[model samples]
Target: LKGQIHGGVAQGLGQALMERVVYDRQSGQNLTGSFMDYSMPRADTMPDMEIFSNPVPTKRNPLGAKGAGEAGTVGALPAVVNAVLDALAPLGVKTFDMPATSERIWQAIEEARA
Candidate 1:
């Protein structure tokens, strides 16, 4: 479950900030078609993750426990995206769309600079 949280946070960060599945408007070729052409999530690109457990068991399960497997992803994704936005807020870049590609981030940075 912990690993799931960490990995999902990392993936969601990439997906929300650095990864994309874009295709060319003219030829319909996916801009991220190849592995080499696609931006991927890497450990060195992220910050350390810390998970806190509330231990307040839920009513949805039989073991006095809620499902942790997918819950971490459900929760961490937002946190990661929000963190990115917060980190970039000083530059007047407050709003962002998903798959926050490098192109997009760079554009926002440029726009902020302008």
Candidate 2:
């Protein structure tokens, strides 16, 4: 369960911060056709996570257990995005898009300042 949660969170982090599919505007060709052109989350990029499980009995299930599949991933993406927005709130950065790359962040900051 722990491994599943951790892996899901890693996947979520990648989607939220690093994963983007780029295409050529003129030719409609895929720009990020391979791993070399794509970015994924590495071990060094992952944040330390502390997980706590609160098991609640489900009335609909005979086992009284709720599935934890994709639980971490489902929350992780928005959590990370919200965290970044919160950090930049003081800078008047009210909105941001996905794959919150450093370049995009800098652009947001600059726009806010302007």
Candidate 2 ranges with C-alpha deviation above 4 Å? 43-45, 54-67
lDDT of 1 at 100: 63
lDDT of 1 by residue, 23-97 (tens): 899999888888888887788877877876667777777877654554555655687678877888999997767
Q: What is the C-alpha lDDT of each candidate?
A: 0.72, 0.88
Quality of model 2 by C-alpha lDDT: 0.88
Using lDDT as the measure, which candidate wins? 2
- Scanning candidate 1 in windows of ten residues, the lowest lDDT window is 66-75
Q: Which sections of candidate 1 miss by over 4 Å?
A: 43-50, 54-67, 112-114
The TM-score leader among the candidates is 2
The estimated TM-scores of all candidates read 0.62, 0.79
Q: lDDT score, residue 27, model 2?
A: 100
Residue 48 shift from truth in candidate 1, angstroms: 4.2
> How far off is model 1, as Cα RMSD?
3.7
